[model samples]
Target: MKKYDLLIKNGVVVTTTDMYACDVAVKDGKIAAMELNMDEAEAEKVCDVNGKLVLPGALDVHTHLQMPFGGTVSADSYLSGTRAAACGGVTTIFDYPVQHAGETILGLVNSKKEILEQDACVDYAMHCCITNLNDGEILEEMEQAVAEGITSFKCFLVYKKEGMMVDDATLARLLIRAKELGAMINVHAENPDLIDLNIEKFLKEGKTSAWYHYLSRPEFVEAEADKRAVHWAKHLDAPLYIVHMADKEGLEACIEAKRQGAEVYVETCPQYLEFTCDVYKREDGRNFVCSPPIKGQESQDALWQAIKAGLIDTVATDHCPFQSYEKDWGKDDFTKIPNGCAGVENLYPYMLDAANTGKISFQRVVALCATTPAKIFGCDNKGSLVVGKDADIVIYDKDKDFTITLDSMHSDYDHTIWEGKQLHGYPVQTYLRGQLVYDNGEFVGKPGMGQYIKRSPKK
Candidate 1:
């Protein structure tokens, strides 16, 4: 019998902290060995990855698969969405399973279990959201959820009228409890008073254009909320993660809190890194409308510098998608526009291209797109390309380059915000646990093939 099932030879191996040349051997769905040289006859199958880059499959920790909001469902289901994720070299995703008042959090988990079991094309988990904090039964459910291996909980402070917002008292209570339970709180921080006040003011002035949407949600809306959330978490000494942060003030506040010994991690997205508020000037500006609206180039530059300086912990997509025309809900009223954009499929190539262009080192790209997400969310076996880790890997050509277009993409939407943008490289093959699932833009993995991953591995 052969010593290994598969061997990848002569690739430049990259992890979050280091890069080197190695021939990786795989056996029984795990990385079996890494060495500078291995005998070709030791493996039953061998692929020479000379001149290619071998990196870990990415993890998109924030996505809304088949989510319903603003009178329409999000554009992608779990299968279709993870298919896009697979094609883009992402092998694991942590989607949101929202819980409302009077509902059991695990019940939501049970309901989503079948969808993931029957339709997911990649490994998956969820961060339970407390949509109705006053439901009295939820605090107990939160503890049970942690027992079952979901290590993070999500909360919003900006959707008061929609019943998704939690008051400061409730947020503090949740944070304090999460600290005791060993789970982290992921927050959507925006001062609803500021957001609502600006919206009301704009409506009264008849400034209801798409551009006004960005105007109504200025940087202070996110800044004040982040500062407040940090303050409370600092007081309690609890772990908190601020999601999709786009403002310079918010970043600075997080850095200051960390310096004072608060346990906080912050995430920002590609839309914030690449585009600015100028996107609102286009005829289709409504498509770019999302909560905590994109900032100007000045903020983007500051965010990049912070990321380079190691002030940020993770980078995620917040991949909530809607169709191009879905913005029509707010044609006459900017307040009704569904705030989201599609991004999962673009994470890999966009970051790789950033490395190709000298924007970031290749190792930092791995840290942001794959390694740190697993560490933050408790997927011990899923992030790095190392011995004993799950064999989730990507073989990519550094020379391949292309411009993104709707015709070449895989999301369920008819249009993309990244359409016509250029990508410096693309993945040639993607593997999950030593199994080939995507190649040349085709998905070969079946639904139900992806196993549920609890933050702590089941014994």
Candidate 2:
């Protein structure tokens, strides 16, 4: 006897952890009911899912929206970035708040505030980066950020000379703060000393090719840092989240740490699963360069295997884009090329290709790409399709086939690493809180309508 705003009937609704066949009822921008049979007369709008997968909208927890890096800016602004994300079925994305050298934590927060307030098109959150933990005053400001709902902070163990990396002692201190503040420490784990040594050696040998970028920071470097970060997190009893776990070795460290009672979680990006070091070593390699560069084919197989075995926890795009000419910014020196690849529009479909190939289940795909990231990042109300939650949803067409073209994509970057790859399944329509945001490869929503999400205190 209750009226609803919209009804999606007779569909298999997939959540992060479970699946059900039900008719979802929405009213006033939230899920109002989910029943086996709901009369269409009770709703103002109706969608016939026709047995397509009805999934909770995805949440991309790692993205570099309108970011400045390597003396240039990432091509995707919040307007372009989240619009691309919405087209890919992601409704929420958490971008990093990068602190430049000498900037206060609060100042960095305000700077990002200006960008998000003016641009974002879908829901968003942020992870604060700690560039200078040595300063006690700045260190104390981290707790204030946590209280303000920035529940995670990022620390780099590499790029020490670049002022972004945190030394071991500094990392330990921040981990302790994270523990006490009940916030998550997201680590960019690559050993700075080893990478520096390798880069210097490579430069001396005149090896400035794109492949040398991967050779300079191989699996062992990431493995060593992975182990060290896990070691430090365990020592401080801190909650740690490892970003961009690229290889089996990295996942092994995470699994071992988790088994030993360390609060460590691993997130792998689409590039690691879909592309390999071979791609970065090719004539087209420059387009694929990202820090913690893509590893060997064996490592690629291991990542998918680990996902199946439950060793990996989540999949994010790490959506950082620079233009084609900018992609060669590292051509003069491999290290100078900015890290990140464009995939905000491809994360879900690329993963769907994996599922279609029998590498993972649809449920697992949703878990890695959407549900887990939301729960882990504390976006409780938006990740799953349950009654009383937000009506952020994606209607996926299993039979839709599309070849990826930069012409059809939305990133400001003119090229993508996935430029010619074909995708089997894609989102036919994406809705945020019952409103259509993306349809037929276009964004219908206006900028600044998306709200800034603040995480609740961690349990």
Candidate 2 achieves a global lDDT of 0.85
Query: Highest lDDT: which candidate?
Result: 1
Model 1, 246: alpha-carbon shift in Å?
A: 0.4
Candidate models: Cα lDDT each: 0.87, 0.85
lDDT for predicted candidate 1 compared with the true structure: 0.87
> What tens digits encode model 2's per-residue C-alpha lDDT throughout 254-302?
8988899888999999999888898866776888899889999888998
In candidate 1, what are the lDDT values of residues 1-459, reduced to their tens digit? 999999999999998778899999999999999998899999999989886999999999989999888888889999888888888898998898778777778889889988899988889989988877555677777778888988888999888988888888888888988888889899999988878898999999998877888888788788999999999999988999999999999889999998988889999998999999998777888888888889888789989998888888877888888987788777778888888888888888888888888988899989998999888888999889989999999988888887888777777888888999987778888888988888777777777667788995212
Give me the runs in candidate 1 sitting further than 4 Å from their true place: 457-459
